[model samples]
Target: MLPFYSLLLIATWLVPKYCLVQLNEPFLYISATTFKFVLTSTLFLTKLKMKMSKFVCFITKKLQNLSIFVNPFWIQICYFISVSSVGFLVLKVLKPRNKSFRPNDFDVFFMSVSATTVSSMSTLEMEVFSDTQLTVLTILMVLGGEVFVSVLGLHWLNSKFKKQETQNKVIDPLVVSVEDLRYKSSIRYLSYVVWAYFLVIHIVGSTMISIYMSLVSSARNVLKNKGLHLVTFSMFTTVSTFTNCGFIPTNENMIVFSKHSGLLLILIPQILLGNTLYPPCLRFLIWVLWRLTKREELNYLLRMNFSDGIGYNHLLPFLHSCLLVVTVFGFIVIQFILFCCMEWNSEALKGLNCYQKLVAALFQSVNSRHTGESVVDLSIISPAILVLYVVMMYLPPYTTFLPRKNDEQSLRSNEKMKKRREKLVENLLFSQLSYLAIFIILICITEREKLREDPLNFTVLNIVIEVISAYGNVGFTTGYSCERQLKHDGYCKDAWYGFSGRWSNEGKLILILVMFFGRLKKFNMEGGKGWKLM
Candidate 1:
């Protein structure tokens, strides 16, 4: 913790000093804040690449000797790069790919981060990133809600290019066929269908919330400046939860006129947004049952699946998604209750209105799985709430978005051919489950004393929490940023010394990692062998 703060402070001072020194070179000159920002971004990208570098090289070498062109690691890397870039591209271009398809891992990762982080929470737009950058990112995130669909579109482009006799063919041949194309296309369409449920409910709810806030108690005076604030707020939130950025432009000190409008609009959308994203568990359930029952209809739908992948044909996706939903919401509800009963419960509601409190709870749950929106003052937030966040931060995405092959010989099953197939599946599944639990427990036990002492120590618990936070792209904090305020006088003084957001060097790095991890496929984090999600 001490090192963390010290490094941050040093960066704050050093970057500006360096920038000032470089000022004579007009082309190279930039603000200290911007320079620090780039430096932080570089640190994050470097670390992320380093984290996967070894694993990727190992997989590549193994595949090289065996003639598996375009190894799984390449797919994963491509998935990350594509998901991020394509989503930005599509929003502007209005390309051919629709929502019904499931994309490869890169596209999926893009969609996952786009959807989960809810980039709509971002206030910056044509004003901040240039009209093109804003428009591209927004559209990609808004329309491209699922990583799977993006993967589909990218693969299709590659396929068409391949046929056109392009130079490179990165996606393996198995992923190149028309059958795969149709299946994936169908999946993306279904995602839009899923969006329909979220859209309508979101529109109706957000509209009502906006109207209420616009006309409600103590709103008229303060809200006079930004009349369309409510409408834009609603739409942005729709984009946010739909995408999951959880960024709120208005908070306690700012946007008084739009206070309730901001909170209600921001929080409510996530409740439905989390449900709209990929339905991995549902697909999984369908996969297992489809295998055992040999149901003709189920098989046909999957065969005629509307998109690139067979996502809707199985119940596994639905089940897994339900688990994810429960895991996130369950933790939030439990924490909310615990907070309500705590001694400082009243303090939790210190200056917030009812809508704000509701928004805070919902935001907490939603961020548990995706992007974090820490609207409530963290200083007042009890340790219990932080614990809940830590717990959610460590829990893997309840649903494994990767396509599982339950065929005669899965990576897990082939090893135990001597054993019954069912026995092998059970053994592998349980063993991994056991491994996860033990590994987590060991990390906790090893770091328990540190956690107790500082609770904010960056140990295994912090690493685990960081990983999970990265998984959903939800940014969690002990008392980081504007999410909480100056209960500790020193922190308040630190704020006046410089802009908190500008000063946040390490925080920026953590955010980039979270954003990258935020887009990573759920199962990939679990260490499944020979299973390239893309």
Candidate 2:
């Protein structure tokens, strides 16, 4: 009876969406179902709270006990699964606004996965989505993109409390070591600070984007419900930039905002700080400011070391700061210089003035590293530029190197640290390279017939770019067509001419796997036990 009721309630909530797609007389059925379930659930929950139903109370208690297994790993996995599932369900429920060119179930699921993974790949046109659908995509981005250190910290806290004995008051082995305790403490503090940090960054970035959008008369006219549209667009840009989830609301993406320097200004720093590099860069900034102020009290706070009053733990963060800054900036400068020298007169940059070209180069460099957004068309770029992008994306996140402990005991500890760092880098490289390799192999095998049929339409470079995009989770494509032959007959001309929409089901499945691995590998690399402080 309980199981039946629960399933009924769930179905009732979903009926409206399903009805819109399937049934002609949906409203009557949906409204009746909704009312019945709502009334029944209200009565049952109310009665259970008043101790009128022992069965309901038992079920509630069981759910409470089961929640103990909810850790960060499972939470992340669940988030991915939930987003995909909800997206699949939504697509199944909603009827297409246009009768002619309705997206199949798989197409919806693929786009959902792309959005949830932040891969920025899309088979269907984004410009056609209703406001409700965009809202759903935005929510998925927020959930999937942002790092949930807070949830991780809370789980740690729960584990700690659960381990305490009422009589013996024994400390668990997990938290017994000083280093372990310190790590846990750091996580707790980080979890607390991370939300506030995200809020501040988003507010600033969104404000700038909003201002830029308002200043542009054309943009204002195109986007109706000015205030709401600005906020929605700002949220999309903010999350997309900061989380490195590069799902642009508009089809044109950064190209539309090319003239808006104010928007680019916001995007540049957000991309730099939003990627894995942000933490170290932030620590460096704080340290520099503290040094200039020369405030001894603030030094302790900034260092994030409450127990060690000597400020000895600053070494790791300092080193991290230096390494990230030099590596990222160096790569960007080299790439920008190369772009100017090699592709100065390319079609992508032909319309742009010198300043705009410089900005475009900078944007591409930053975006290629992780964020995946692009102001210029990647398809038209020279091989040199494409190679640069591949290299940048292939390199692990700038913050991949784990700094050695400040106070090491012996040569063994130092050697252990070195080996751990090496292993981390190795894992990162292997993770990305393996994905790229598999994707390439699959493309060749699955797309062999198609390639032979239309050699001009499907080139090796097109496939390589797609694989790189998937493996890096960068989402930039050479606008490859989905079918072997150009079905549109050159009707829709965009830089993404040979984009994901044209890929076969088998090819898309392979890329989906690539995106999953690209995202999952990061979580696996970060979660493993190699980072334990000595």
Candidate 3:
């Protein structure tokens, strides 16, 4: 502990000098003040070291006791809430690009929640947001991304394991299990792999995007006309795509650059790596590590059975990993064929050559799964294609094809009796679909007036799509059109916002809850499984 304080004192002294060189004068002044305070406190504490150590130990024990009653699930919920709240305040204080376009408090708060949850459901147009606000949204997306959150969880679990191991060594010097050691090491290694994956993808994606924008005249001109910098657009697009948040700096999302097939192709891998294809990519990385390192922990990660292995869910068995890749691309292929066939000559895909159309179709197919960047206006697309998109959005990111094996059946049979006993006390509550149904009903109730007044634009299918998109955390929407209104009133005006933008405040709040539910959906993967339809 004395050594810890010594290191802290050294850091306090060095950090202010570093900040003075790198940061602005204000930050340097703040750091200097902090350094002085810490220095004074350290000198005083050294004089009263014996008494201060006892006080620190007492506080640490009290904190440990308090942490025992804190649930991890609640901690996650609190994290989102706190981030969203801070984002909301920041957005509220920051000025938008448009001087007259001040977003309402609720809309700002809604955007914060959407960004924090990576929902990307927006009520305001993207162009109104300043570059600073866009940067904030990018930060929220990165912090709220699945990979980032999982890595944080892994780090926390690793620390907990180390703490427990230290206690075990104190209790009995030779009592540590080899399996526990391997599991802990595997977690730490996995954390490193994920961190590398996150950084490498962002760096590569941003670099490629920047180069493409610089080399391509059309894309560069589009950013220029919108008053966006090359680096800002590249970084924002990469972060948004890799997080699968679907937030584009432009109002049209990916539509304006649809003809830039090369740009579309570049973003496709980023979309996949961040969401649906994450599991297969992760398993492949682990497999490669095992092949190269021949380490026991890598082998444990690669060979462990999903059901009884290390608690990490992304590390799938080899067979399942292969199946996941097949299933993911199989669905994409189906959607691609259907999209090209049906939309080749449609107005939705007008003005594109055969090559561009093909690339755009494939891009849209990949995005429909979870990444919701769209090249075509989905409203103009064939209803059949939209229905297929809905189905794709409803499926979870890791949905895969797995054939039941005889060995797995035998293993399940061994647990059948225990499952049956557990089922006796299991509560039959709302399933995932049940919850979605409730959200849909609530939104319908809240938007009933508009549903009747603008049935054409506010169709039940559009409502379902919006709700499902929010629940899936995919930002796809059919979009609202003033011309499509049943009766064109004088107040009708077209805006580049999602379908949910037309909904009342209550409906937006309901969608907010849906986004929260969707973000934390892994906890409910087994929901409604306790009920037997037969």
Q: Give the per-residue lDDT of model 3 (tens digit) for 1-534.
A: 677767777777666666666665655645464444445344533544445335434443443444579755666787788789999999999999997889999999999999988888999999989999998888788778888777666766666677788898899977887877888898888887887787778767877787677667789899999998765687789888999999999999999999999999999999999988888898888778878988777777877877674657776677777887899999999999999889999998899998999999999999998878999998999989999998998888878766745443235434743776544433454588999999999999999999989899989999999999998999999889988877988888888889988889999999999999988887665566667787
The full ranking of all candidates by lDDT, starting with the best, is 3, 2, 1
- In order, the Cα lDDT scores of the candidates are 0.43, 0.63, 0.82
> Residue by residue across 74-180, what tens digits does model 1's lDDT show?
55545555556655454434431233433333332333343334432221111222233333444445433443234333333333443433322444545467755
Tell me the deviation in Å of residue 108 in model 1.
Answer: 24
Model 1 misplaced stretches (Cα beyond 4 Å):
1-76, 79-137, 143-231, 251-266, 275-329, 343-346, 352-363, 399-468, 478-511, 521-523, 528-534
Residue-pair clashes per candidate? 65, 10, 0
Instruction: Please provide, for model 2 over 1-534, each residue's C-alpha lDDT reduced to its tens digit, 9 standing for 90 to 100.
Output: 567777766766677556666675555554544454344434444443244224323432443355577544555566577667787687656654354657767778887888777778777766545556776676566556644322333444534533432222454344355654454554444444454455567666766666556556666564663223555566677777887878777767777666555567678998877775675755665566557876543354465532333222222345555666777788888888898887778888777778877788778777887788888777678887897787777666654344545533233334544786655754444334555776898887888986776676677877887877776677887775434364445563443322667778888888887877776664444333333347
RMSD in Å for all candidates? 16.9, 12.0, 9.4
> For model 2, how big is the CA root-mean-square deviation?
12.0
Best by TM-score: 3
Q: Cα deviation in Å at residue 80, candidate 2?
A: 2.0
lDDT-superior candidate, 2 or 3: 3
